[model samples]
Target: MRAADPALDSLQGLALGDAFGDRWFSVPIDELSDALAVRTLRPAPWPWTDDTAMALVLVRHLITWGEVRQDALAGDFAAEYGREYHRDYGPAMHRVLRGIGSGGDWRAITSSQFEGHGSYGNGAAMRVAPLGAWFADDLDETVRQAELQALTTHFHPEAVAGAVAVALAAALAVRTRGRRAPGRAELLTEIAGRLPDSEVRSGLRIAARMPDRTSVRHAAAVLGSGLLISAPDTVPFALWSAAGHLDSLPEAIWHTVAGGGDTDTTCAIAAGVVAARTGLADVPPAWLAAREELPDWVAEVSTSS
Candidate 1:
């Protein structure tokens, strides 16, 4: 039998974590608080949101083409969003995908979002981890591919930075396989070296300085966790959680959830990175079973590849 693809493993971890984290969105504040206090998860059949949807599209494209071809990726993203319109896409993303589906120029549509300032949202970062693992042998290539992919829907520097950061984290995780997990300082140094000057980079630097024993609430207070849905607000905390919990996939995801902002995306990013190192063996069977199956095309590609 063929060995499982590491990239596919990362994607499964990402999608499952995305779905698992999403379950918290519907819980009452009191109930959520109680669950968190005990580190308990919500019920099963956890449905994923746009984070998994978009990541699957990217994974499918990679399996078919071996690299991100910008034009084809744009089309695939549009087609995926159009088919899965109920996945809670953000308004800005909806506009971009709709335009792309209608044959509008992807570059123009992406650059024109948010009144021409483009988007600084976490959308780009949410779906990019597998790309990192795919190019893990080449950190430079991972950053380049991550930027190209992010530019399809997000043109803002911060958004691109967030994508690059997550990609680097995943690549680093893959690189650390069978070795000791990277320390926070090592991970941050590598990521910061690749990232350009941006709020996301600054936030990651802050994350590096955060003590290991810091509580999630304290960490979240110092580093925002997507409460504003911006790259700067999310990537730092997600990376911090992933680095701290590289040995425990469930704990990494739980830390992301405990941070309490844009839970699904944060957990998705964190889980993807840690899973590159730990795979799904450490993830709870119940959580994996609860996630919706990945897109059929993604499964077909993985099987046939």
Candidate 2:
């Protein structure tokens, strides 16, 4: 219970962005296009998906342990997944979580994914911002904790890199909260420098070079927008959006969703990272009202030590 405020802000932004982006999938293609052009507001009670679901578990894990204990984190993930399996989890995750719930070892369950190549999914990246916020004062520890949490399910190096990048982004956001963060190039350069050699790192480097005036469609096409449900396809553009809109959670999300691929996860990643810096300060009332409420357990834990 040490300064849960920023972490809670990140969680709220994550869940809100998840719900907001998920809502776009329900509209007709023509309507969606028109809506995007005008930035139409969606109806109330926007529901979140597995992105928010998994993030809740992550925040709760951080609340309970204040650091990653992989075995315990795995158990909690399985238990949560067992209770709710309809949150739009990918096929690989279903198998891994089911196996873990059946008392299988976390390593064995995760290692079995993709015929032992393991998963490179964005699930890890999408849910890690609060952890970064939690350990903002110690970025090395943030990377360590982020990797440990990611290895519970997403075992690929790309996925680990994705989590590391996102966590470091959030930590940096916290470190610079309430102030002007570094410029886009400097911010992305710093993030990319911390990552291991991987597609995620390469993408961040490319993002660093891209001009800020670039259109969202062009940017998403270049950096990718989670089309593959993989970390490399998602993290960079999400981070780019975050770097540009660190002062506004809703703006970061709008830019993310405009990319039009795996929006819930992308928005979740971007909003979580942005909110780690901006908190809920710039969230519009309508956006806040449209998002579904977080689980009561999250509130309970936020209030607890």
Best candidate, lDDT-wise?
2
Tens-place lDDT digits, model 1, residues 198-284: 999898888888777898888888999778999999999999989998888888888788888788999999999988888888776
Where in model 1 is the C-alpha error above 4 Å? 1-4, 26-30, 297-305
Candidate 2 residues 184-284, lDDT tens each?
Answer: 88889999999999999999999999986898888889999888899999999999988988888878888888888888899999999988888787688
Cand. 2 Cα-lDDT? 0.89
**Which regions of candidate 2 are displaced past 4 Å?**
26-31, 301-305
For candidate 2, what is the TM-score? Answer: 0.96
lDDT of 1: 0.88
| lDDT of candidate 2 at residue 257, scale 0 to 100 | 88
